[model samples]
Target chain A: MIEIVNLHKSFGKNQVLRGATLKVEKGESMVVIGGSGSGKSVLIKHIIGFLKPDEGSVMIDSVDIANLSENERYETRKRFGMLFQMAALFDSMKVWENVAFALIRHGKLKDKEAKEIAVEKLRAVGLVGVEDLMPSELSGGMKKRVGLARAIAHSPEILLYDEPTTGLDPIMADAINDLIIEMKKRLSVTSVAITHDMHSAYKIADRIAMLYEGRIVQTGTPDEIRNTDNAIVRQFITGSAVGPIKIEGVTA
Target chain B: MIRLIELIGRFVEILWSTLMSFARELGKILLLLCATMKQLILPPFELKNTFKQIIEVGIKSLPVVVITAVFTGMVLALQSYTGFKRFNAEVLVGTVVALSITRELGPVLTGLIVAGRAGAAMAAELGTMRVTEQIDALETLATNPVKYLIVPRFIAGVIMLPSLTIVADFVGIIGGYFVGVTVLGANSSVYWKRTWDYLEITDIYNGLIKACFFGASIAIISCYKGFYTEGGAEGVGKATTGAVVLSSMTILISDYFLSAWLFK
Candidate 1:
């Protein structure tokens, strides 16, 4: 459903992505694993039509989204939903309003119907009776759940999750992983999730791609990744400090 | 001698770079203004959000504007009375006060005050939204952040600044009346007559027009700073400060040119 080719991005003197490329099939869960600041977020941002690549194209269903006009890109984005690393809920809005935002604005649904759908989506994410509460009133895990609810509220054809399991306890993270699995099964949507959490990546990804130094170093199933011979992939999956991957801001 | 020449070259280079950066920032702000104008004519006018911002930028600013206008008028009256007493033209205090308040103080003071208050608030709010990724989330949901966020503020600022200036003008005239006739012991009927005699409708409308420009500047500058904010909490602080500073400078600087054109 999505294909990125030879993508290159730079922020001033910092070259974050250089010749990175990847592809994902429809209705498949593609998890991108990378260390912090590995341009994982940048890659997905390209797919979602947020950032334009300097060198290459991001093709979604054969259309180069990088070249679309602002209005056209906005139309293309209707098929997408994203959960930010911080949940990024509208602090000014109620939980239900955040979830029902697209429904009211884009879907053109009335308040009553939008609220009903919001409530149903919240329930699907295992959240009940917290619709009227503000985002500031929720815990970290609850905020993530609420974000998930908001993401899936419009039943988007594709979903993107940025560090969905980070900052949560192991149990809470596991629960989020399970929710990701469940949502993929229920909605049958294409998803691209970026995370450093190997456990969550293994649990939720149908195929895992390891992003290293602005390129996809390896792509394989969980079992294959666990048993890979590539030193970088093996070192990353094993969580070893001593590895070929140089830790940023650290002297070897 | 060689060192002095090198120092001069370095200073010129620094000055040129500063000017270039200022020009770039101005270009960005103008682009934002154009984008906002484009969105303004587009469909999906957010009336609810606009009304909310009107209250935020207009009605809520009433007390401070009124207070400033009243004090400014009173000060103008007292100062004019003292100055005119030398030539025994004390009776003209009302005329001076009325003209100054209607044509200059009313809109300028209100603009400065709103730029400090509403402009800063708008920047802080939008900056926080940008850093927190709520803005990105909005884009992902197929919602135009500029339309949903900035257009309402632009409408509110444009609508409310003039409205607030009107209130300021009225209150300021009343203040001058009290100080000139009651406190300073000028003839009540003559003071009232002189206040209206020299104050033309053109003066008030010109001031209102200036207020419109100030309002647009405040909204556009604040939104631009906020919408592009980076670096998190510290970035928010900087954006808020930059909004107020830039808005205030724009108002004051533009006031001179606007006065030159409008009055001439």
Candidate 2:
């Protein structure tokens, strides 16, 4: 289980996350929905040890990961698989190498053995025979699939996805959402996905958490989130410009 | 009077902040260097990547170092001849050329050349990785990027700069020989004799030592700039330019001090 409590992070004066708290139970898919710059990425980054919180704790499997030493954090990170927003495949490596990265690096698998597994994972993601190609050669959907293959390649205990379907078309996004669901079911991995896509959240989430401004405003099942009477939740879910949520400086 | 006081207060604040920012960045770079050194001493050192960077920083830099050395030597020889002729010390022209090339110009020129070529490239490549989130990906894979990306480059810089400086020194001496013997109609044997007699092993060693430090500084500063880059494409461009400029300035400034310390 991953538990975050009262996380506070600020970059200069922007104050990206303040008192943000959420939790993901073991073997559950928790989709975090937030607008752009809503600190979803910051929250996940804190969990992954990329950023340290100013005033809270990130407990991963009962240990506060925020305070772990660098070596300890690295050791803890071995069980994590993250798919970045842009797929973030190493352009220096071929597609297979990208997928097989964690396996070869941390899993201590031989290159040939890792390659075979990479090929299998690619096939599982519906990408076939593209192992020799570079990431630049792949399309947006293909890159995301490769990213997904890379994420699940090591059978990590926790998988973090950052805006996985942001750039894809509706069909591709739905396909990705289905893949996330399938991967969760197949791997039994605890998943935390940050996305603004409500449809994706509805499809993939066992529970939905909405981050408004800095803090998590609501956490409930997708049905509850959709049917909530809270104006903030309703305004975001309905995709309306007119609401209690102001754009700050813009007059609408 | 009140307006002037406020203006002075604002200027002081800006100046203080700017200096503080510089100090902060310097501290970060020093920390990065220490981490790179620690990772470098650990087992599983990357031999292949180090050799690749050596080729990139040393072998690929050969032509530029050669051209710079040759011109510098040729100019030094000509200038030395003009100065010594009036004093009837023409025989000492080769000695001056050899000493200046071995003790100063060789390492400094080679450093600047590599800084422009390899340092800028390192910064740009790493900056691109930063913007593309590949560096963050390395972390997620449980790989310390300092070990994987930086240590190899630092090793290459430390190992290859001296080697490149040796090439630059030899070629520069040969360039001086060419100008002195062939171009200026100076006696070939006398010129060679003076060069060999006056140039000591210590001079060459000092220059090579400077080259090693120059190489490490270029690598560390370039990697540091690249690693911390933000703002996407424009940031990468700025980092690349900054790497080249800063590395070049460092080489020149530190060359003076290293010369003083080594030769004092």
Candidate 3:
């Protein structure tokens, strides 16, 4: 349901996306994998209108976001929910308020009704007796769960995950991965995720797209990604620094 | 020389771009306000949030404000008396003190002080949120960052500033009275009566109006800077400093325009 064509963006001297193009069919889980600072976040933001492409178009369900008015973009944004890399919960608000944030934003339900829905959603995410707790009070896994619950609270048609499992321990990360899979099956929502974490990408993505130098070099299934012969893809999946992906002083 | 020239050009460009962005963001706010004007009078007023913000920004700030205003009033009286006594028109000390404090100093100083306190804090809080991507997360949840987050502060600024300005004006006049009547051995009744005698309705009104505008300007610019903050922790620091400087400058500059308009 998303199409990006000839996307190019530059921040002063550094050009990130140069003629990058890609498409995802409806209800498809497309995982975009790239190294840190490889412009993956920039690309996802373009699709969501957080950052505008310097010279290209992001078409969501046939509506070119660049052409839409601010109000229209906002309306379109309602269909999407983004889970930020850091879980990005409003610290001042409690866990349920964070989850029911969309309900409040949609401006339909009253506080009492919204709180009920928020409690139910929190329960679905395996969080119990936690509505009163602030985001700072929760553990990393709990925060991620709350974030996931918030992302799905509005019943959004599109779910966007930005590094869904970066900071979690292995067990918690697997739990999150299972939740992603469970969410996909239960919601039937179109999912697009961007990540540098391989274990996360492989665990949750239905189809994997490798981003290199700001373009998708290869797009394939999980099995295909595991057995891919492409050098950049191999270097990336294997987590090697001494391959086609060269490093300076930093190690992954 | 080449680098200097380029720097000049870049500074001009940045200025132009900032002005444009400010215009666009203001346009967005105006449109939303017009659309929500009906909602303003509707139910679900969210008065709870409004009261919370007023307490947080206005009530909690009372101690510092009281100290600043009272001490400032004392200082202004002491300084103005020195100048007026040289001309042997020291009896007009009450008039001079009352006029300056009520008409100009009250609002301006209050604006500066609050801008330094609440304005910087607002910027820092919002800036940290922006850097941490919490603001975007707010948007994705369909929260109007302006309404849910900003309107409370805006309303609080408009309400609290006038009260604060009144306090400043009152404190300043008392300070002048202390210096004139007690310190300078003038009659207490005469000094107090003279202070009020010269104070016009417009003088107090002028300062109060200025306070409202100052409050709005500081709230808007500080909130905008923090809302649009990028980078990270350092960026938040920059936004905080920018908020204080920009709000202070806007208050001073706008003071000129407002006084000119009200007096012209």
After the best TM-score superposition of candidate 2, give how far the Cα of residue B17 lies from its true spot, in angstroms: 2.1
Residue A75 displacement (Å), model 2: 1.2
Assess each model's interface with DockQ, reporting 2 decimals per model: 0.94, 0.90, 0.60
Query: Model 1 Cα displacement at B244 (Å)?
Result: 0.6
Worst 10 residues of 2 chain A by lDDT: A243-252
Candidate 2's C-alpha runs over 4 A off are none
Q: Rank the candidates by DockQ, best first.
A: 1, 2, 3
Candidate 1 docking quality: incorrect, acceptable, medium or high: high
DockQ, structure candidate 3: 0.60
Per-candidate TM-score against the hidden true structure: 0.99, 0.97, 0.87
Clash list (residue pairs), candidate 1: none
Best by TM-score: 1
Question: What is residue A249's positional error in candidate 3, in angstroms?
Answer: 7.2
**Better model by TM-score, 2 or 3?**
2
lDDT per model vs. reference: 0.94, 0.93, 0.84
lDDT of 3 by residue, A1-252 (tens): 999898999999989998778888888888999998788999988878888889988999988999887668778888998888899999988998898877875757888899999999888888889999999999989998999999999889999999988988989988988998888898999999998888888888889998888788999998999999999999999998778886735675
In candidate 1, position A162 carries an lDDT of 95
Q: Candidate 3: RMSD over Cα atoms?
A: 4.1
Residue B239 CA error for candidate 2 (Å)? 1.0
Report, in order, each candidate's fnat. 0.97, 0.94, 0.70
What's the ranking of the predictions by lDDT, best on top? 1, 2, 3
Residue A96 displacement (Å), model 2: 1.2
